[model samples]
Target: MHDTDDAHSEQESSAIHEPRLWRDKGWTARVIKNEDGDGWAVEMIRDGSAEPALVGPWTMGRNKVDPKPLDATAHQTLVKTASEVIRRHEQQLHAQLNKQCSIETESGSLTVRLVVTPDEFEPFGTLTAVDPFGDVIATVKVPPDFKLTRTRAERWAADGFGRIQ
Candidate 1:
């Protein structure tokens, strides 16, 4: 009755969609012809990104004309390597966005930090100073591309923690 109709609908829906070429561990692997050289390359793209997270050389078959077909083991390896690439990229970005510098101030050793918050409309940054005891002394909004250096940190602290325009 109604159950049979529902089952038929589900089967039709499944049949209408084409199977994915390659999917593993939240990533998709695609092999493309190398433009620069006479070989092939593989690209690993994360689930939601149009750009590939990682692209590298792929093995050639014995005929030396075509790329070897992707298999389960190759997909797993590509996924692992792509995940690592994404992880490293994130870590590098985090380090660049958040910087810390130490300077000797009259009061004591002060820690200067520059934290950047990226936004689509307007990116913002903050320059902060903390005492040796981890107490925030001052925080000022700065340009998102502010660079934290020892000399700049000392200057900011010596200027009474005012805006460094």
Candidate 2:
């Protein structure tokens, strides 16, 4: 006979398709009360995540007071939307932490890249200059808020790649 704990674990791991809840394909769709209004809302949460990736208004049922029952099609749509939200958020964060520019120097053209490390205690940025042949000419540690523009890269190159004030 299976133990009670094992049975509970098995139930949790299996797919659930209830009217207000649907869990499958590593995502869960749940209908919840809208705190901001009188209507109902649906939230999509990825498995193992603590918070929902997407939440929006849910359609009303025929009676007009209750929310529409969750279906396979609705769950799939929610998963797609929630996945897109996470992807876009990651892209935005990457853009914020990494920057690149090209500048012409006396020696040759160099590509300057600034990548910021988001440390909790000591956030910092690394400024790197690479030649056209992909050789790193110079690298320096800078403050996380350092802006990397073309003009700034040219000035850094002109300053002998020393510490920036």
Candidate 3:
């Protein structure tokens, strides 16, 4: 869905020569090539529900006249270049939202059922457990990006049960 207008704006925003990839730490990335000029472009990905934040042209080599062609090395390099951008953005976003919650109890880890009801009046998540008795044991509001990993699930299972705080 991107066109020339978007490209111009994205490049203008990041107009300085970033010699080191890790110098900027406020963006995430996807390495790409500008089809028009056959040059490399790094699409800066940002944290949250928003789409790609920025996109810009990258230098080719020492000459600077010919842009670097997008290949596996270039792609990986750009990804490495933007790693800190993604990380710092994620940290800032997490700090602002404070989006983490867990419940420990004595029985076994109950599944967290995040009930996202947009009632206009009560705009919140009803994070309850998917237990057999169908009782909503706990509730909290967390960012949508939060996830329950398999390893954590295994740990919860190992404990055999308890309400987490």
Candidate 4:
């Protein structure tokens, strides 16, 4: 009987430190009152990131005046959705930052790569070409806003890989 009580007390103590507004598991889900109107919103934040990865409206209670109270099932569902949001955001960012395409040069087929560096204040990218033997043929700095597309890359290769104008 004493052991059972001790285990229960231990679980209760651990729960005390849990955040009321947030839950963390390499990411966090936080509930907040919606700013625009009557609903609620949940914000998903990844660890070490300053911004929320996702934010969406929450459900309303039967009364229609207040948000449905968050419970274990709702919290679990929110966490799963939030996790996917972060995963998709990461994939999109990766795709934007690193792009590669192949072009047929007079010499041979060359690989073109566009890698972007995004920063808070300034953004920039590099366009690079590699020969069949893995030798870097040309490298150019491009504006961060540069978009890498199949047509644009092909045009660059056909134009002798010069600075994009």
Cα TM-score per model: 0.80, 0.89, 0.30, 0.64
User: What does candidate 4 score on TM?
Assistant: 0.64
lDDT value, residue 152 of candidate 4: 87
Q: Which ten residues in a row are the worst by lDDT in model 4?
A: 15-24
- Sliding window of 10 residues with minimal summed lDDT for model 3: 16-25
Residue 94, model 4: lDDT of: 96
lDDT of 4: 0.77
Residue 103 accuracy (lDDT) in model 2: 93
lDDT of 3 by residue, 31-67 (tens): 4567667766667554342665456776666676555
Question: CA lDDT of each candidate?
Answer: 0.84, 0.94, 0.50, 0.77
Q: Highest TM-score among the candidates is held by which one?
A: 2
- The order of the candidates by lDDT, greatest first, is 2, 1, 4, 3
Would you list the rank order by TM-score, best first? 2, 1, 4, 3
Which portions of model 2 show Cα errors greater than 4 Å?
Answer: 1-12
Q: Write the per-residue lDDT of candidate 4 for residues 1-165, one digit (tens) a residue.
A: 699799767655543113335453355666688988778887877667899878888777798866666555666676788778878978999997999988886788889899999989988899999988999998888998888887888888888789995
What is the model-wide C-alpha lDDT for candidate 2? 0.94
Instruction: In angstroms, give how far residue 162 of model 1 lies from its true place.
Output: 1.3
For model 3 the local lDDT of residue 40 reads: 68
Pick by lDDT: 2 or 3, better one: 2
Superposed on all Cα atoms, model 4 deviates from the true structure by an RMSD in Å of: 6.8
Summed backbone clashes in each candidate are: 0, 0, 20, 0
